[model samples]
Target: MKKLLYFEQDSSRIRPIVVALSKHFEVSVAGDLLELAATLRQKEPRILLFGLASLPGAFSIHILDRIKQIMLNLHEEKLASRSALSVVVMHGDDSRWQQICEPYIAALREIPFCDIYVIPAATNPDELAVSIINIKRANRHLRTARMSATAEVPIIGNSTKMRHVIEQIRTYADKHHPVLIVGETGTGKELAARALHFWGKRSHHHFVALNCATIPETLFESEMFGTERGAYTDASTRMGAIEQADNGTLFLDEIGSLSLASQPRLLRVLETGEYRRLGDPHPHSAQFRLVSASCINPIDLAAKNKFRSDLVYRIADLVIEIPPLRHRAEDIPLLAAHFCSHFSKDAFSLEQNALDKLCAYHWPGNVRELRSVIARACANNSTGRIFADDIQFLYQWKFEGNSQPEVSA
Candidate 1:
């Protein structure tokens, strides 16, 4: 079980929550700042939770400052690394308490590993336990993302075109201009967008993504711009993608599918960095880097009047075109090996004939289809080795411009 160090002055109030979390973590409770510092040195826990509600007067900047100092001391002593520590601040949902805690929480946000969770006053122990576990999971994911971002570029391919694509991503990652990623279906446009985001200056902030193709036209505005409480019948307060992506990257996938009527609304936000929530007369400003993807050429759509030319120019400040699988057949072997290792539990290998067959067929669905085929092949193989017969092609296609081959089941 993972270790957790929790600080709260009143033990009885948090006893039930601690018991509930025991099944998921080996939890240690600290009743004072001194005890908390002692536990940090001895426990070497990865997660630290501060129950600000249980502190005297329900909130104190001095306590938080001391906690931060303790954390800094741990790092200075080479005891806990920033990546190894995740901090969670918990408080009751009382409006007055929340208002008092807002600025302090904002200050804590500077610590990249810190998160805040608001607990309803009536929340049961089980609900609180679940929420804390989810926060821990999110912290783990963020740490992993940070590690990946700092390492080598995450895109996998050695083809000349792919290398050029990687170079483009690295070059434009730190730039504030909007980037438009163009590719065919399943050609990894989103992957390129992520690489751009993770490699950029905004990596420390959120990376919120929304698929324009999947949302209905009626909800596009509400999804892009947030909604205030009671915006409509049964509507609750919610932060939309734009607000959630503030100070970070906003990825709009299949941007060509965005309704024409909603184009100007988005264009205005891009131009002015300001937006108004649904049913709210107030305007809020957001600062985010725009990264959009489209399977279709926005230029072509603009020419046909299917898309707005001005919006196209705004989003295409920097464009990245991802080549289809067929155009980069040389990378099939590397990609195949990667997928094989990922899908198979034990060691697996592909025969030369199997490789030949995979490289010969034209991949209409690009890398996505190749991954599925590799997964299916791994499932079908019994000898831990894959042969041409073990590989299944879903669609019959001409190999090397010859007659169509047999479709495998």
Candidate 2:
């Protein structure tokens, strides 16, 4: 377990947070400023939790000045080498606590921590675990720089196009900008979205994916922003995907299907980080990273007024396009063998004929279609090796009334 240095004086009140975090990290609690400094020296914990709620009641400029001096002194003392420290300042969510903590947040910003998180006292534990794990992964990556030869891509495939996709995922992981993935259906758009979320800074929170096309426009707003009890006939209190994905990622799939009527609503939340539940007059704040995917050309759709141009601009901060499987035929053999192994009972191999057929096939359904074909082929093949005949004859059924075009073998 990773070490966590928690600096909270009133452990009785925030015991739940400590308990929750203990499930993930080895929590070392410090009761006061002096104990905090002692724990920092003894534990050398990279991940620190600041108990800003326990700040001095006196609230003197002198007290603030003394705190700043201590922080600055630590900076100078640790300046000789880089520290692997990450900090989180937790505060209550109510009005008065927000007012009190805002200045302290600004004050801590002046100190040089690798990253600073201003977390709410009421944050969901599962989501908090995501944040903790993200930081832990990053820290491990940083420490393993010496083992450079062992570096690897979390996503599969060695094709040039896939490599480009991987590179884009890596580049955008650290940034808070919204990402838009464009590709044909079955081209692993959601998989790529997962790569972005799990490998990024916000990897510690929930990655919520909603398919706009699958959901009706009548319920789109309610689905995206949630609904309150009695808001509609038989409506019960519920949190929307956006609110649930707070400080995490919200992946909107088939983004082209987002209705124009609901587009402005999405735009408002993305711009202001605030949304109102159905029948609720007051707006609630939710800060989440937006990652959207579309099979159609959003730019072209915007030109035709099918998609909201402003919403497109807000969500497409970084865009990645995955090429169709046909365009990356070199990866087909590797992908085919992978799927074949997934279905086969014994050690698996793909015959050259099967690979040739796969490469020659018109992949209308892209990667997903290919996987299904390989899976079906393996189930039919008693022999450990997959041959061309075992593969799905996707074409040649015209007289039987298959809609797809017939092609010569």
Top candidate by lDDT: 1
lDDT of 2 by residue, 101-187 (tens): 446545654564434555445345554555556556644653453143222323567999999999999999778899999999999
Give the Cα error of residue 34 in candidate 2, in Å: 13
State the lDDT of candidate 1 residue by residue for 49-143, as single tens digits: 77776554345667777877787687678776545565666665444654565566555555544443433332466655655665566556556
| Pairs clashing within candidate 1 | none
My TM-score estimates for the predictions, one after another, are: 0.67, 0.66
Backbone clash total, candidate 2: 2
lDDT computed for candidate 2: 0.73
RMSD of each: 7.6, 7.8
